[model samples]
Target: MNLNIKILNQKEINNMKISKKFTSIFLAGLLSASVAFSTPA
Candidate 1:
């Protein structure tokens, strides 16, 4: 039972890390895209 709880907590931590990475990447992409779109061609 303790092992299962530890596994669950580890999974949650891993998921949170993955989500933070993805969110940062997504926000950076959006910022670059906005800059490119705003610039005159």
Candidate 2:
């Protein structure tokens, strides 16, 4: 299915990119921390 979407301005696009990058990094760190705590050395 196709949906109509509005275009984003340059500043908005840049903000979106930065937020997504930050979210990925945060998730990765959380995952690593959980694994470290759950697994025995």
Candidate 3:
């Protein structure tokens, strides 16, 4: 049981890291898109 809990915790930690990376990438894309729209070609 303890081993299972540890495995689950590790999975959660990995998921958190992935989500944080995805959020940062999403934010960066949004910022760039807004800047692109605001600037004149």
Candidate 4:
């Protein structure tokens, strides 16, 4: 039971890392897109 809990915890941590990375990438894309639109062509 303890091992299972540890495994779940590790998975949760990994998922959190993935979520943060995805969020960062998404925000970066949005920032770039906004800059592109706001910039004068």
- Candidate 3 Cα lDDT to native: 1.00
What lDDT score goes with residue 8 in model 1? Answer: 100
Q: Quick one: ranking by TM-score, best first?
A: 4, 1, 3, 2
CA-only RMSD, every prediction: 1.5, 6.0, 1.4, 1.3
Q: Lowest lDDT 10-mer window, candidate 2?
A: 1-10
User: In model 4, which regions exceed 4 Å deviation?
Assistant: none
User: Candidate 1: deviation at residue 22, Å?
Assistant: 1.1
| Candidate 3 TM-score over all chains jointly | 0.72
Model 1, global lDDT: 0.99
Off by over 4 Å in 2: 1-8
* TM-scores of the models, in the order given: 0.72, 0.67, 0.72, 0.73
Residues 1-41, candidate 4: write the lDDT tens digits.
Answer: 99999999999999999999999999999999999999999
Instruction: Residues 1-41, candidate 1: write the lDDT tens digits.
Output: 99999999999999999999999999999999999999999
lDDT, candidate 1, residue 18? 100
- lDDT against the true structure, per candidate, is 0.99, 0.84, 1.00, 1.00
TM-score of 2: 0.67
Kindly list the per-residue Cα lDDT of model 2 for residues 3-22, writing each as its tens digit: 32333465678899999999
Task: Tell me how far the alpha carbon of residue 3 in candidate 3 is from the true structure, in angstroms, after superposition.
Answer: 1.8
By TM-score, is 2 or 3 better?
Answer: 3
